[model samples]
Target: MLREFHVHDRKALLDAATQQGWDPLPAEELDEDDLHDVVGAVMWLADSGAEAEGADGLLDLGKARRLRSDEGHEVAQWSPEPIMEDFGKGWLHRASDQPGDSDQSEERTDFAALFAAEPLHCDDPECEDEGCLWQLTPRTADLLHTALTVLADEAYDDAEELGDKRLLEGEHEGNWGVFARMPKLTFAADLQWRRRFARAADDLADDLEHDRWPQPTCTAEELALHFALDDARDLHDELGYEDDADHTALPE
Candidate 1:
């Protein structure tokens, strides 16, 4: 069924299920809705230029429960999270690494500062006056964000997992706490910090554009990633969790 999309490179993905030990729909059942979804997902993956080899790990991300906007574009990443606290402000963007990481571990060297720094003024998130908010220093923010990102990931992993797609759109509107769902964005909850986070998200989007990052396509994988990243950043939010805003992060 996926072959109807005319994606020449799909030999890899089509054959992937066999190697991964999942059975494709039988020829007689090719017209089933489930098969159609799987095929559509595969086509979307093909359009997004995703490498299907690594996908051998899991195939359910493109499933119905995953996140994807109505647009063909997937929200694979949230590239700007201007974390603020008593420590001050620092930029954060996820790279499919733990949301705790400033970048990847290889790209990060804040450990020396992170370890030497003062412990969060209040390690307890539920502490009175919120001492945890004071720990938002660059190093501390990464540390804290990492901790929250990890904890959330663990809890949600029991929840589920998905791969990265990449969302780095244009200038996000911070006023109403709205950011680009495509490219990289979403509501930050703290309306005051929304401006900075919006800028940061825009800058990250620019960088991705300059680097020629691939645009998202209408595929199962890309769609799954977009929803995943959106959910990931929402977990560590200082304010916006309950205000009827959407904050999604990756499960995997």
Candidate 2:
């Protein structure tokens, strides 16, 4: 019959072993007697704080354990990358750099040339008229950066919708069908770029309202609201909202 060891038995066994100056038995060799002895030794060592060098070392070990557990959990919970798989391994590198492909490189070069050749109008009305808002503002840039980041994050889901919508419309479509149907990330980038442009317009409106620029008939607040409404109307029309044609367009 296997004997059960209790707290009193453990304490007594540990005390007897200590008195006899005998080393504790290994875990595999442990019966009721050994378990009692080990538990007593553990409890005594815990109370004395003599199991390790110092309290700081034990605290540090606890912190390390917690950090490692957190990191492991994060790794385990990681979601698969969405758009990266769709675009292929070389797509990002190729899209950004256009390396090795003369045709794509030339296209990028042409776009740069076109952008440079076009009249670079600051979206800020004040900047456009007087060039006062041209100085780079960190606050403005940070706001734009945050907005762009959010837009980029949302673009993957939008891109999926675009792809799925297109696929459903077609009778015969394959995996490549999704790719062919979706608007390019370039298109989403352009949309985000337009929003940044709108933000610049808004900043200019703010400056005007604050009397930073030449006097205007309407208060800056009024003009800003008007432009914002116009933007909303434009977006509504673009998104195919069914409204009277006259109601959606800006007044002449």
Candidate 3:
């Protein structure tokens, strides 16, 4: 039925299914919907430039041509694109292995000093009076932000696994509280950030009506710092830390 329907790129469809850990149905056994889904998946994978070589090598041209001809559809040929460039291809290779200047190392050390000197703070009002806000540091803030980003990305992956119907729930206390207490405010902040980062991308996608970039107003560093403080407050509330761990290391 799939072959008869002339579903474009049937082999590629089967290949994608195999790559996804699913046993590809024999061409003779596939129904229309199955074939349609396979074709759609293949097209999606190809468009995303995913590297998945299933049963056939990349771009199985023979199968593609047959499917397109059978379906009376235009067969678009896949081109081999250069993924990267070698700067020294046409130039002489400098053999001197002298290490580059240590400017970046010095700058990193200075940045670390600045980070260490900054006061840490908790977001909770109660903690503020007791100087509990000083429990979070710049490094911790970076870690917290990275963790949240990873969590969010995982949620997105889960949503995809569930067929894209999942409404992601914020797992972090800071994000959840802000989202629940002031959804509009949170949304506005997100929008503002997106607008800042998206200006350059928006220009590139001028021809596209719906192209958008993630908001990038506030520095990720700042967001991470705030997130860590908020998370630390939530932790304080939940864990009820001893005075030693919670206060001695915390800056006044």
Candidate with best lDDT: 3
lDDT of 2 by residue, 1-252 (tens): 111223335455466546545466676777875563475454344445453211112111110111133234343356675323342342233454332334442221121221122233566565645443343232222222233323333433344344334333235234332222333442333333333333344444434233343123444323333444444444544534354333223221
TM-score of each: 0.22, 0.20, 0.26
lDDT of 1 at 103: 34
Candidates 1 and 3 compared: the better one by lDDT is 3
Against the true structure, candidate 1 reaches a TM-score of: 0.22
Which tens-of-lDDT digit does each residue in 170-208 have in candidate 1? 332331122333234332233223323322333332323
* Candidate 3 residue pairs in backbone clash: 120-133, 120-134, 121-133, 121-134, 122-133, 193-215, 193-216, 193-217, 194-215, 194-216
Model 1 sits at a Cα RMSD from the real structure of 19.6
All candidates in order of lDDT, best leading: 3, 1, 2
Q: Residue 160, candidate 2: how far off, in angstroms?
A: 3.5
Local distance difference test scores for all models: 0.37, 0.36, 0.38
lDDT of 2 at 98: 33
Cα error, candidate 1, residue 39 (Å): 3.8
